[model samples]
Target: MQNIWSIFKRELRAYFDSPIAYVVITVFLLFTGWYFTTYFFLAGQADLRVILGIIPFAFLIITPAITMRLISEERKTGTMELLVTMPIHDSSIIVGKYLAAVALLIAMILPTLVYGITVAFLGDMDYGPAIGGYLGFLFIGAAYLAIGTLGSSLTENQVVAFIISLLIMAAFYLMDKILIFIPNSMVSIVEYLAIVYHFQNISRGVIDTRDLVYYLTLISLALFLATRAMAARRKR
Candidate 1:
C-alpha cells in the first residue's frame, strides 16, 4: 500500500516536472472551451449535450498524449530497470502509474464543471444528464488510458507509444461504424464489444450495470496486460 502511494507520488510529480503536462492540459482546455462556447451559442439552450458529445472525441486525442510517456519513457531512459528492482509488486507500479494518469485526467476534467454551473444559471439545465456525462467520460477515459498504458508498455519510444495508442483508440472509436460489414449474427456481438456503445448507454443518464461492467472489464484486462508486459521485462 505504502509502496503504491510512493510510486503514485513519484509518477504524479514526474508529470509536473516536465512541460508535457502543462502543454497537454492547456491545449485540451482551450480546445474544449472553444468548442463549448461555439456549441452553447449555436444551440441557445442550457443543455450541455453537444459539449458532452464532443468530449469523447477530444479525449480520443488527449488521452494518448497524456499516457504515451507513462512507461515508455522509463524504458527508453533505462529507469525502468531501477524501478522494477524496488521492493514492490509489478501490479503496484502499474496501478500507481495508472492512478497518476487518472489524476491528471481528473485535473483536465475539473475545469469543465464551470460549464455546468454556467448552464444552470443561464436557463433550465437538466443536471442529471450532465452528471451522467461526466461519469461516462471518466469511465471511457479509464478504458482508453488502460489501452494507452498497454501501448506504452509495448514500446520504449514515446512517439511509437503515442501512435500505437492513437491507432488502437481510433479503432475503438470507430468500432460501431465498422460493424456494418459484419454478419448479422455477429453484429450484435460486435456492438456489445464496442466501447462507444456502452459509453453512449451511460451518457444518456442511465446507470446500467452492464455498461459499468463493460468498462470495468476493459480497464482490468488492459491493466492486466500492462502488468504482464512489465513482468516479462524482469525475465528478459
Candidate 2:
C-alpha cells in the first residue's frame, strides 16, 4: 500500500511537472465549456443532457492524451527497468499509475461543477439525474483510463500508445452505431458490450446492477491486462 501511494505521488507529480496535465485540462475545459454554453443558451434547459452527450467524444481525445506517456515514456527513457526492479508487485505499479490518471481526470471533472451550479441558479433542476450523470462519467472514465494504461503498456512510444488507445476507445464509443450492420440476434450482445449504452442508462437516473457490473468488469479487465503486460516485460 505504501509503495503504491509513493508511486501514485510520483506519477501525479510527474503530470504537473510537465505541460501534459495542464494542456489536457485546458483543452477539456474549453471544449466542454463551449458545448455546454451553446446548449444552455439554445435549449434554455437546466438539464445536463447536452453536456453528457459530449463526454464520450471528449474522453475519446482527452483520455488517450492523459495516458499516452504513462508507461510508454518510462520504457522509452529506460526507467521501466528501474521501476520493475523495485521490491513490489507489478499490479502495484499499474494501479499507482492508473490512479494518477484517474486523479487527473477528477481534477478535469471538478471544474465542470460550475456548469451544474449555473444551471441550478438559472432554473429548476433535478439533482438526481445530474448526480447520476457525474457518477456515470466517473465510472466510464476509469474504464477508459485503464484501457489507455493497457495501450501504454503495450509500447514504448507515446505516439503509438496514443494512437492505439484512441482506436480502441473510438471503437467502443461507436459500438452502438456500428451495431446497426449486425443481425438482430447479435444486436443484444453488441449493445450489452457497448459502454455508451450503459452510460446512457445510468445517466437517466436509474442505476442498474448490471450496468455497475459492466463498468467494474471492464475496468478490472483492462487493469489486469495492463498488469500482465508489465509482468511480461519484467520477465523478458
Candidate 3:
C-alpha cells in the first residue's frame, strides 16, 4: 500500500512536468467553455442541457489522449525496466498511472465549472443537478481512463494505443445510439451492455447503484486486462 502511494504521488507529479498534460487540459477546457457559452447562454436561455451532456463526449478523446503514452512512453524510453525493477507491484504501477491520468482529466474538467458559475449568476439555478452531472462525468472519465490504460499496456506505440483506446471508448460511448437501430429482440441485451444508457440515467442526477456498478466493473475489467498484458510482456 505504501509503495502504491509512493508511485501514485510520483506519477501525479510527473504529469505537471510534461507539456502534453497542460496542452490537453487547456485545449479541452477552451473548446468546452466555448460550447458551454454558446449552447447555454448565447442560445438556449441559460439551460445547461447541451453543456452537461457534452462533457462525457469530450472525454471520449481526452481520456485516451492523456493515457495513450502512459505505458508506451515508458517502453519507448526504457523506463519500464526501471519501474519493474522497483519493489512496487505491477498493480501498483497500473493503479498509480491510471489514477494520475484520471487526476489530469479531473483538472481538465475543473475549468468547466466556470460555465456552471456563469449560468448560476445569470438566473435562478438548482446546483444539485449540476453537481451530480459533474460527479457522473468524473466517474465516466475514470472508467475511460482505465480503458485507456489497458489499451496503452497492450501496445508499445502511442498512435496504436490512442487508436485502440479511442475505438474501445467509441464503442462504449455510442453503444446506446447503435442500440436504436437494432432489432427489438436484441435491444435488451444491447442496453445491458450500453455505457451511455446507464450514463444518461446518472446525468439526470439520479446516481443509480446499477450505473455505478457498471463503471466499477468496467474499470476492474480493464485493470485486470492490463495486469495480464504486463505479465505476459515481462515473460518475454
Candidate 4:
C-alpha cells in the first residue's frame, strides 16, 4: 500500500510537472467543448446529451496519449529494471500507475461538468441521465486507461504503445457498429463484447448489474494482463 502510494504520487507529479497533462487536458476540452456547444445551440436542447455523446469518441484519442508513456517510457529509459528490482510488487506498480492515469482522466472530465451546469441554467435539465452520463463516462474511461496501460507495458516506444492502444480500443468501440456484418448467431455475442454498448445502456440513467459487471470485468482483465506483462519482464 505504501509503495503504491509512492508510485502514484511520483507518476501524478510527473504528469503535472511536464506539459503532458496541460496539453492533453486542453486538447480534450477543446474537442469535447466545441462539439457540445455547437450541438447544444444548434439542437436547442437544454440537455447534456451532446457532451455525453462526444466524450467516448474523444476518449479514443485522449486515453491513448495519456497512457502511452506510463510503462513504455520507463522501459525506454531503462528504469523499468530498477523498478522491478525493488521490494514493491509488480501489481502495486501497475495499480499505482493506473491510478495516476485515472486521476488525469478525472481531471480531463471535471471541466466538462460546466457544460452540464450551463445547460441546467438554460432550461430544465434531466438530472437522471446527466448524472448517469458522468458516472458512465468514469467507468468507460477507467476501462480504456487500463487497456492503455496494458498496451504501454507491451512496448518500449510510446508511439507504438499509442497505436496499439488505439487499435485495440477502436476494435472494441466499433464492435456494435459492425453487427450488421455479423451473422445473426454471432450478433448477440459481438454486441455484448462492444464497450460502447454497455456505456450507452448506462448513459440512459439505468444502472444495470450487467453493465457494471461488464466494465469491472474489462478493467480487471486489462490490469491483470498489464501485471503479467510486468512479471514477464521481471523474469526476463
Candidate 5:
C-alpha cells in the first residue's frame, strides 16, 4: 500500500513539474470555459447541457494526449527499465501511473465547477442532475484513461499510442449510431456494447447501476490488459 502511494506521488509530481500537465489542463479548461460561457450568453441555455455534450469530443482529443507518453516515453528514454527494477510490486507501478492520470483529469474537472456556480445563480437549478452528470463524466474519463494506458503499453511511440487510443475511443463513441442501420434486434446488443449509450443514461441526471458497472468493467478490463502487457515486457 505504501509502495503504491510512494510511486503515485512520484508520478503525480512528474506530471505537475513537467509541461504536459499544464498544457492539457489549460487547453481543457479553456475549451470547457468557452462552451459554458457561450451557452449561457449566446444560446440562452442556463443549464450545462452544452458542456456535457462537448465532454466526449473534448476527451477524445485530450485523453490520448495525456496517456500518449505514459509508458511509451518511459521506454523510449530508458526510464521504464529503471522503473521496472524498483522494489514496488508490478501492480503498484501500473496503478500509480494510472492514478496520476486520473488525478490530472479530476483536477482539470475542478475548475469547471464555475459553470455549476453560474447556473446556480441564474435560475431554478436541480443539483441532482448536475452531480449525476459529473459522476458520469468522471467514470467515462476513467474508462478512457484505462484504454489509453493499455494502448500506450502496446507501443513505445507516443504518436502511435495517441492514434491507437483515439481510434479506440472514436469507435466506442460511434458504436451506437453505427448500429442504427443494423437489424433491429442487433442494435440492442450493439448499444449495450457502446460506451456512450450507458454514459448518456447516467449523464441525464440518472445514476444507473448498469452504467456504473459498465464503466467499471471497462476500466478493470483495460487495466488488466495493461498489467499483462507490463508483465510480458518484464519477462522479455
Candidate 6:
C-alpha cells in the first residue's frame, strides 16, 4: 500500500511537473467549453446531453495523450528496468500510474461542472441525469486509461503507444455504430462490447448492474494485461 502511494504521488507529480498536464487540460476544457456553450445557447436545453455526448469523443484523443508516456517513457529512458528491480510489485506500479492518469482525467472533468451549474442558473436543471453523466464519464475514462496503460506497457515509443490505444478505443467506440455490418447472430455480442453502449446506459440516469460490470471488467482486463506486459519486460 505504501509503495503504491509513493508511486502514485510520483506519477501524479510527473504529470504536473511538466507542461503536459497543463496543455492537455487546457485543450480539453477549451474543446468541451466551446461545444457546451454553443449547444446550450442554440438548443436552449437545460440538460447536459450535449456535453455528455461530446466528452467520449474528447476522451478518445485526450486519454491517449495523458497515458502515452506512463510506461513507454520509462522504458525509453531505461528507468523501467531500475523500477522493476526494486522491491515494489509490478501491480503496485501499474495501479499507481493508472490512478495518476485517472486523477488527471478527473481534473479534466471537474471544470465541466460549471456547465451544469450555468444551466441551473439559466433554467430548470435536472440534477439526476447530470450526476449520472459525470459518473458515467469517470467510469469510461478510467477504462480508457487502463487500456492506454496497456498500450504504453507494450512499446518504448510514446507515439506508437498513443496510436495503439487510440485505435483500440476507436474500435470499441465504433462497435455499436457498425452493427449493421455484423450478422444478426453477433449483433448483441458486438453491441455489448461497445464502450459507448455501456456509457449511454449509465448516462441516462439509470445505472444498471450490467453497465457497471462491463466497465469494471474492461478496466480489470486492461490493467491485468499491462501487469503481464511489465512482467514480460522484467524477464527479458
Screening candidate 1 with a backbone cut-off below 3 angstroms (N, C-alpha, C), the clashing residue pairs are none
Off by over 4 Å in 5: none
Question: Candidate 4 on 1-236: residue-level lDDT in tens?
Answer: 99999999999999999999999999999998888777777877776887787788999999999999999999999999899889999999999999999999999899998988998899788988898999999999999999999999999899999999999999999999999999999999999999999989889999999999999999999999999987887576
- Model 6, residue 8: displacement in angstroms? 0.5
In candidate 5 the C-alpha lDDT for residue 2 amounts to 85
Write down the RMSD of all candidates, one decimal each. 1.3, 1.1, 1.4, 1.0, 1.3, 1.0
lDDT, candidate 3, 191-218, per-residue tens: 8677777777787888889889999999
Query: How high is each candidate's TM-score?
Result: 0.96, 0.97, 0.95, 0.97, 0.95, 0.97
Error of 6 at 31 (Å): 0.5
What is the Cα root-mean-square deviation between model 1 and the actual structure? 1.3
Give the TM-score comparing model 1 with the true structure, all chains together.
0.96
Per-residue error (Å), model 6, residue 77: 0.6
Please identify which of the two predictions, 2 or 6, would achieve the higher lDDT against the true structure: 6
Clashes of each: 0, 0, 0, 0, 0, 0
lDDT of 5 by residue, 25-69 (tens): 999999989888887888888887787888877988898898888
Which segments of model 2 are wrong by more than 4 Å?
A: none
Runs in model 6 with CA error above 4 Å?
Answer: none
Candidate 4 or 3, higher lDDT? 4
Query: For model 1, how does the per-residue alpha-carbon lDDT over 1-236 read when each residue is reduced to its tens digit?
Result: 89889988998998899987898889988988888788678766666887777888999999989899999889889998899888889999898999899888988898888888988999778877888889998999999999999889888889999999999888888888788799999998888888888888888889999999999999899999999997886688
Worst 10 residues of 2 by lDDT: 39-48
| Best first by lDDT, ranked | 6, 4, 2, 1, 5, 3
